[model samples]
Target: MDALTSVTGDGQHIEPRTEFAPLAVMALTGGEPAGGQMVSFFVDDPEGTGTDFHGGSPVRVTTASDGTGTTDVPLLAGEAPGTVEVKVIADGAHTSFSLTVNGHPEGNSGA
Candidate 1:
């Protein structure tokens, strides 16, 4: 299994205040069909200081026949920007990746 840095659905690297961010997960099964297979995603915040998931953690998705899947997870506004670890599990396979969320400028209050 592999996690994409920037999924095609969003076409942007995840950052602070990024809402409904699309995350793509790919699983390799020697060409085996993956349609209808369950794929689960979760975020691990070691310091307990990171972005928030709008629909909560451990979002689930169904993979396509090509063993690919996509899901949207929101990064709440004002979240402490830092390295966020994302994990994906599918068909008994697990993979993880880290993404850096750019911090918002201080004292730049929106009008």
Candidate 2:
């Protein structure tokens, strides 16, 4: 439910939002015109009780393509909407942002 922002290497900005759903999981991944590599994104659901909105289960999401700036993350089974922590390690190349579950900016339910 909190606002998230994505920063660029040289202090640029790209604010985006994603939706939540039955297969909702905080997405993690990115791409740049040039430079930046050896990075990994992880989502964690620390509670481990099918709760814990703040991601602590540590789900790894890979780029949609080899060099695409997109990742598809699947939420944990029976995961209830709440808060989750999304960690992005992009070799300190690009800044990261939070993608909310059940929070669709376009108001389009995947289902």
Candidate 3:
């Protein structure tokens, strides 16, 4: 399979400078799982924003023999809330998705 089938996150809003549950990426072949593959994760920050991948981006991860992988994307503290584009590539197939970051409310400590 050369196409990304699906991309999803564990939460809708991500807290800045925090490591949340990984975003899941799925690959498929003929509607079936394309397992045992190597995939790479990338983040596209056009404006040189404060988003940080924690040395995670541009990294390759092997699928769990089920055509599924996870990406750990983190933002720096004081980073503005906005949408970010994430690119995934595998075996000449590539796809992109947008992730939204939610701002922490004032006077509320992010615990």
| Per-model TM against the reference | 0.69, 0.36, 0.73
- Candidate number with the higher lDDT (1 or 3): 3
Q: How far out, in Å, is residue 14 in model 2?
A: 21
Predict model 1's lDDT versus the native: 0.62
Q: List, residue by residue over 1-111, the lDDT tens digit for candidate 1.
A: 323222343323455666635677666555454566688888777745455567678888887777677875554522666666667777677766566666667866888
* Two-way TM-score contest, 1 vs 3, winner: 3
* Candidate 2 segments whose C-alpha is farther than 4 A from its true place: 1-32, 46-68, 72-78, 99-111
Residue lDDT tens for model 3, 1-111: 756754676234577665544667888877778888788877776644456567646757777777898764453322666666667789888876666666658866857
lDDT for model 3, on a 0 to 1 scale?
0.67
* Winning model by TM-score: 3
Worst 10 residues of 2 by lDDT: 8-17
Candidate 3, run of 10 with poorest lDDT = 71-80
| Candidate 1: 10-residue stretch with minimal lDDT | 2-11
Clashes of each: 0, 16, 0
Superposed by TM-score, candidate 3 places the C-alpha of residue 12 at a distance from the truth, in angstroms, of 3.3
Which model, 2 or 3, shows the larger TM-score?
3
TM-score of 1: 0.69
